[model samples]
Target: MRLYKIMIVDDEAEVRQAIARKIDWRAVGFEIVADAENGRDALEKAETLELDVVLTDIKMPFMDGLELGAELARRKPNLKLIVFSGFDEFEYAKEAIKLNVVEYVLKPVNAAELTAILDRVRGTLDAEIEQRRNIRQLTQAYQESLPLLREKFLLDLLRGPMDPQVLEAQAERFGLAVREGAYKVAAVCDIVHGGEGRPALSDELVPVSVRQMLSDALWDRCGSEIVLGVPSILVATAWERDPVESLMRLLGEVCTECKRILGVTLAVGIGRPCQSLAELCRSCAEARTALEYRAVVGLGKPIYIQDMERLDRTAPEWDGHREQQLLSVIKFGTREQIAAMVDKLLSDGEGEWSDQSRVLGILGTLLSILRRCRLGEEAMLGPRGSWIKLLAEDAPMEALRDWLLSVCLNMSGCMDQRRVSTAKRLVEEAERYIREHYPDSGLSVDRLCEHLHISQSYFSTIFKQETGRSYVQYLTDVRMEHAVELLRATDDKTYMVAEKVGYDEPNYFSYVFKKRFGVSP
Candidate 1:
């Protein structure tokens, strides 16, 4: 709706005036804002005026249009420039292109040709403005609705046992398209330990930005867009093309790049390929299952689902005794006791068992207990303690039990030196907080900021910089881990566990839990 301001620069006043008068500028939504008789004068005017397009003659006193154009470009990259030259020289045209001039017209320009050039430049400017606006809108929307969109995306991908068509349609709606073929899901895990005195990793792992880079990289390599389901990066490519190998290599490269460029550590787990979108849920499950092996496998390493042997049915079923023991160690045991128990479990070698599955199961059970305990505490502590309700949730006991065992098994292997001690310590501190006060409904960034005696922005930046995770993400991880515990150890309803974990809304809680574990809580 606004008029584009145009500027004309030429050595001769007649030439500049003649060209300006020839065009019906108003009809084309343009206004001739200024005229300069030389390049030096043109440069001065460009700096002073907010001009959209500059038409200049190549030859001028004091400053040649070429030099002036170059300087203008340096000062304002977004400024559109057009050059007119008496000499039809290829060198001048090439220089104009290098300076990113919008167009080059010869002296005594044909009216029709000049009009066509103007039309083309106008179209380009319009498109650029539109793209910028779209990007802004999308970015704003994403920022305001991040938590909700993230939960929904992960829920749809991990839970819902949905039909293949439905899944594909969902992907399409999100602007993610995958070809019909084998696909694998990858979970990127960043661990932050308290008392590490190191920078947080959150700034380095902005899901949207990371997704954009990954999508661009994958699209360039495979000619298809990468479907990003946060914490989970999904790539759909042909098995014959060796999508797994490609994915592993890509993740490895990405990790190395992040470390080199951003000073961050990342662990990636890749699930086996699923033939159809319906089976993608399983793939999601496998990727999360692999994350439990972080300690043993080492951080910043890529773990593949196929690398892990399938669970043997002949193994002894996980009993409540071990679950209770693990829970006790987590709840009240000393660090040494917990460490020793973890080491013993890792070395026990349950023989080709579903180690990943077991860890998720244990986490689920522990979270459930924590949730219930928090809920009861809330009742006793009154409204001030009611905050705990925000982090509690009800999950499927059977599925959670299975997931906990996998988590425990996986964690047992993680006690090695490869898992940075500082990172581990920070994670421990954060975990402790989640366990003790998850029921606090007011447990949020503002409260945490006040408690830490830091600005919210700085606290958020530092927390993410150190942990490689946002506060919400880390909290969700802890809560979901507890959800798995509840799902296994009790007959409590799913919604109840959801509430117990501090989730006021069961549906939203389930969505978040499922996204984390690749199965409905």
Candidate 2:
């Protein structure tokens, strides 16, 4: 409903006033701004005033209608023009057509007829405005998507370690012309804060600032580089002849800037140089390893793959004695002792290693010891009973150490409170397995004992000792519960319920159901 500004032009003031008063210009989506006595004066006002529509009489003394329309068209090509002429000659009509005039109205013009001409001109103006607005909006949206597109491209490149030809094709398509050279992956990360699993809201903008600063600083050294924002680090892929030196220079420049702007120093990690795009994943892994080194090398410090390799040459291999002592505490020590072991593992240099696989192997060893010691509680680690559930490479070391401490203490507490032998845990695990596999007709105590690598006699003794019921009784109880629910909640036949709960013989199922519930099916 926005009104387009209108300008009236004629030799006589009476004619201009009559035209302006002939219609409610506001209702027709046009606003009358000013009146001019001649074409020469109207041209000046049209140029300076930013008028949208011009209504002018053709017969004027200086600079007649056709000459004014042509000059205005050359100057303000977007302005809508309507010509008012008493003479309906071919020359005037042809000249108006050449100037792209929108409408030609005969003067002593009819009010209703001129009003229709003005309405059509108003529609034309509205359409032009809408088209320009749409173009501007599309331009703004495309500008905003550039950063997100760049981030997605970088992440996908590293994840794929994409084939070189495919990588080249994608780079060309996305307008990223990465130079062909050896490349290293570098990451800038915030220092771990207060054992939280992730960074605080105040630190969320740090990665964006880090990416911008690093990309700007490295522009001189590496012409083409990709900076991406990720959860744990601001990842950058820069290609250069001397990648190691480039990474160090990048680290020195950005770390100082981060400290100055963010009020916190950033930890830097640089991966080894890789020759091809296919090797990017390996470089990315090495970069994460370097980042994890902040745990030992100290925060706000840079770590390189070569530095880790040089340190690994002299650092003793896994300390079997220390690992054994740690495992012993996890198996039977008090809560305080277990907590002390976890704190030492994270705070001291007990778990440091140049090879990431070795650290994971040591973690696997800890998990094995817990399993062997019968750590049989769901809440020991987290809601889901998988040990590796929360053990992500990007997880804060302090948080992971806290998790280990809590689980170890829970296991140690269990060992102290009850005679939870391996055999007892075995039987309890069998019961759990049975609950999950109750629909399988092949499930039996013999099969479970075989799977657990224990004698049937020993398994039976501990199964009863732990559960206070025979395995058959426990399985029957689970099946009966399922069958009763199916019977009440479903329209399924008795035979279908029997088969669903692992009873092939429907008659025997009905007999047992009556015995348990004291009712018929």
Instruction: Report how far residue 459 has shifted in candidate 1, in Å.
Output: 40
How accurate locally, in lDDT, is each candidate? 0.57, 0.63
Worst 10 residues of 1 by lDDT: 309-318
lDDT of 1 by residue, 1-521 (tens): 55788898887888887888788887776889999876656775775576778888787765678888887765555578888777666465656557658788886777788888998888887775444334555466446643555447646665436766766776666654443445534344443233323422343334444455455445545534344454455544434354654566566555544443234566666666656656656665556555555544556656764443222112112235665567445434445666555544433275333343444443455455444223232232235323233123333433433333443333433322223453344445555676677866457755664454333333443366677887777777777877788899999998899887887767667656765778886
Per-prediction TM-score? 0.34, 0.33
Over the stretch 359-408, how does candidate 2's per-residue lDDT look in tens digits?
35546666655554445446455565355655555456555666666767
For every model shown, the clashing-pair count is 69, 0
